[model samples]
Target: MKHLLYLFMLALPVVATAQKDSLAGAVQATRPLPLYRPGFALMLSAGSTGGGVAVGYSVSRSVAVRVGANLFNYDGTLKSGKDTDDIQIGFDYTVKLKNADLMVDLYPFKRSGFRLTGGAYYNINTVTFFGKPTKDVKFNDTVFTIDEVGTLDGKANFNKVAPYVGLGFGNPYTRKRLKFMVDIGFFYQQSPLVTFRTTGMLEPSSDQGSVIQKNLEPLKYYPVVNLGLSYKL
Candidate 1:
């Protein structure tokens, strides 16, 4: 992918000159030029945020738009320090994520290949985390099975909507029926809400989920890097 990006970047200057020559020829003729804008494309994107497919449209040489969805998930074990009785507590869990967005891409230079993009999205990116105790938990001096101590779970949600900003290669409105592009950017979201708690067994009276919320505060923003192939229609 890296090599492909390098090759694409190297070819842009040549492409611009060739395209410019074609435009000059078109202008020299008496006939009216054919409409060359308003093309559509199918695109794929991938990064830390996840992977997704999108359908895009070029409204003009400098303006384009697209929409798509993506998914991501992870799992692991977690632990905390021993309680006063010297008993350790741990849990095994999984987290699933989802996101969607509507984006507009803008190319500032009249002939350069770079694109500046920004848009608002009905962002549904969020985390669903759930876990079961790793072993018996001791409470009030009594050791109990993880079953007796209950399972812990929660949904961590970010803002339903967010703004996105990114830069990319290939005009959002590529002239070729097939072209490649690269983009790196992020979504600015608000602090996540981790409403985790124990369920269906020995429930602790204290609000222990606060610690988890504090730990998750840093994930308020989502970063993305994408490589794509688009076919104009």
Candidate 2:
């Protein structure tokens, strides 16, 4: 099954590009294969307060891959000023996956030398919750606050693999100097629930599953965006 999945992934580019090249000199027909562009980008996410930075190179005209890290709150409740400050570090793998945009670029503009990029990424999410949430909140004999228990488990662990698309607007005629672009994409992460107890209580009063599920409710993955400036050699 895994082999089949890998094969399917590898075959996509051939299939898409082949179709484009076969038709009446389409966009794929006009563009050169293995066109290369390399650059850096600053990443900001709705998941966390601070942003992340990434640097990488592109080997293809329509597809690129990069690695980056950013501070993100997996749960909606944690995104605010308090809860736990957690950050994620991971690598991303992307495929143009879709080339309709490349076709769009070939027309209306007579520019022959330009690079278009789109792909996906894999992000390994690691989170740390500061202290515990249940130390002060009393819950009968329950030793730990539900929030604290949730943080120890559900909030602190997970991984996310997401796909993204990017469009480039510049003159390849200038020969790799300076180019600016903005990109938007989407991704998601899920953490496993853990159990913990309150300092003052005796019984285990919190469930990580319920707490994490509730906390992450508000954070929806949509339009993961990036704003970048690139220099190609």
Candidate 3:
């Protein structure tokens, strides 16, 4: 009996070593595992400084769609005079765009059960602009006045829609409680409905509140940047 007890003790370490080896092998095998799930995501994006958010739903492994909105504002100084401290040029332009997009993911990489995806996308965007500003301006030979503040007011406002396409990248959804990603892309399109409302501080005030300076200019096709994130359910 004493001899058998010694043999069992000697075999215990061998068994433990084998179990450890098996566990390590299993971990290494799952190093590249793909994740699959039917899910949805909430995305927020900022590009060239513009900002927005989107909501998307994944119907299959390679296809999904989303819709979203964006808005931004900028301010600066244009010029000033000797008596004047600083003639600030504030561009209070607000851009509102409603968008719908279709996603196609091709490049795929899996690590630690997470699947990463990259592909191309097409989006249709409707953009609108609302511009309002206030400034102090001097006439050809007259001194600037406090009432010039309202006189300097102007606006460029209109709405239009366009279509564009670009590359997109993100993580594929897994059958998990939560998932997230970021997307950046380029777009080419045109906006035809942009109109400018001008005030006559440099000239004279008309009976009408404001006047359209010129016909709306079409926003030509150009590259755009986007970023976003999402959650899975």
Candidate 4:
């Protein structure tokens, strides 16, 4: 009976130690995680602006910044007017979109992916067209050969610095190593400067650049929609 009592006394300390450890673990498990942590991430995206890559840094739970570049180019042919019309023209055109951006994101809610983004883009967007008569063209009552009608070449350029505003979804500081992000926004690029040259009979049309520039006034606000994946680094 004495030995049994000694054994119980010795085992009591070990049992108390085990219970204390178990309680500590339970308290730790129930504790809430931090809302944000600073980190760096890499992102690859595709959207109306084209394909792009960016590097981002989370300054806090509510704010982040990114720097990136995007590019897209298209070359194609366009036909306008009809063969039966006084003039039928075919165009060889190229559209190029290229830009670099510095952006900031603000999150208003804790543990939410929604964010507001504002930024500036170094814009280099252009459209070039070369048009030639596809068939004999009539000027007043006189019909002229394609060679006499000649070709018209023109280019349209936008402002160099554009301001952007938009909203998006994605939080790079989350516990997840990979996250999906999206942005939808618009940037104000101001008016486009149009320039053109004409050869042969089309020389008179060169002065019409102002008219084309006015027609493109609506292009000042460029829309952007991007979908991407971000990997925390």
Candidate 5:
């Protein structure tokens, strides 16, 4: 009995060491591992920046790049009086906004869903102010030609390449296949070039293009807000 009791006591340390090593291995196996595969995503968005679809490619787990196109249009009428005559003139206006862009997003926190974005946008936008006399203007008791009465036609050109900055939510890829996103940003662009043209007596008014340009000074900056959904591929 004494011999058996001594042998059991001597084996205790060996058994305890084996159990400790087994527990350590189990804990190490449960830690999350980084995925090394590349991924892609498709997104649809809408807001002041316009509505469009974008495609993204993952450069790495926390970085991505994308490209997209967007468009918007507006139509309306405007009225003004001729400088030399008391007759009123009317014009039909068409405003168009178009955009093409490339952007990069950086996800700084692996555990959080926030990102910072920067990009460049090329805008092909124009505003046309135009109208013709529906009926001949009775000026000084005589009717006038579009040239004599003056055609109210002018175009404002906003051909610009601008820089953008913004903040957003969502990863280029997620643990699951789908994710929700939100972005708010601004585009920095300068004032546009304007041209005014006419025929007949009012042709001299073309020189007033500078005055027209000043009236449109408030339209230089563009605001953007977007809500989007993305699917991984």
Candidate 6:
């Protein structure tokens, strides 16, 4: 009987220690992981605005700031059929999309990837066009050569400062070191301003810049669709 009592006392501390250790582990497992910490990240992206790079800083779990720049360029030719004046034309054009941005991101949900973003862009977008007769044409019943029909050279520019709004998925400051992100938004660049000059018989066409401007009114809002990869620094 004395040996039995000694055995129970001897086992009590070991049993209690095991229970305490198990309870500590359970508490640790139930504790939530940290979702946000102050940090910096570098991001690379591509979208309608073009290819871009940015640096971002997390101010908190709910807020972040970023600065970035984007650029894209295209050159192509377009052919047009008879105009109102019955003139067929072909144009060689170049498009430039260049911009820098300052943006803020807001996360409304504590454990969500969704975010709202707002920002301003320093825009330097422009289009240059050179148009000429595609074939021998007539003016006032007089047949004229392509050279005599002349050419129109012009450039279209947009507002320098643009405001943007967007929503996106992914949070770079999360526990993961790397993340995938997507953004969909629009920026207001206002109407395009066109300036042009004409040579030879097409000199009068220079006055038609307003017609070009009016036609481009619908382009005031530029759409953005960006896909990106971000790495926490």
All candidates' lDDT scores?
A: 0.72, 0.40, 0.48, 0.90, 0.78, 0.91
The Cα error of candidate 5 at residue 126, in Å, is 1.7
Alpha-carbon shift of residue 63 in model 1 (angstroms): 1.8
* Ten residues in sequence with the least summed lDDT for candidate 1: 82-91
Candidate 6, residues 1-233, lDDT tens digits: the string is 99999999999999999999999999998887568756999999998989999999999889999999999998998876656556787999998999999999999997888999999999999989999998887768989999998999899999999999999999998877789999999999999989989999889777788887886677789999999999998
| Better model by TM-score: candidate 1 vs candidate 6 | 6
TM-score of each model, paired residue for residue? 0.70, 0.42, 0.48, 0.82, 0.70, 0.83
Clashing residue pairs in candidate 5 are 91-131, 92-130
Candidate with top lDDT is 6
RMSD of each candidate? 14.2, 21.0, 7.5, 4.0, 8.6, 4.9
Deviation in Å, model 2, residue 72 alpha carbon: 7.6
Candidate 3 per-residue C-alpha lDDT over 1-233 given as tens digits, one digit per residue, 9 for 90 to 100: 99999999999999999999999999998776446666677767776425766676776665566666665554433322244443333433333333444444443443332233333223333333332223455556666554554333344432333444455556536544444454544444443433334453433433323222332233344345655555654
- Minimal lDDT window, size 10, model 2: 93-102
Model 5 alpha-carbon drift over 4 Å, by segment: 1-38, 79-89, 132-148
What TM-score does model 6 achieve against the real structure?
A: 0.83
Q: Please say which candidate is ahead in TM-score: 2 or 3.
A: 3
Instruction: Report residue 107 deviation for candidate 1 (angstroms).
Output: 1.0
Per-residue lDDT, model 4, residue 142, is 90
lDDT of 5: 0.78
Worst 10 residues of 5 by lDDT: 31-40
lDDT of 3: 0.48
Off by over 4 Å in 2: 1-118, 130-154, 165-176, 190-197, 217-223
How many clashes in each candidate? 0, 14, 3, 0, 2, 0
lDDT of 3 at 39: 66
Q: Candidate 1 or 3, higher TM-score? A: 1
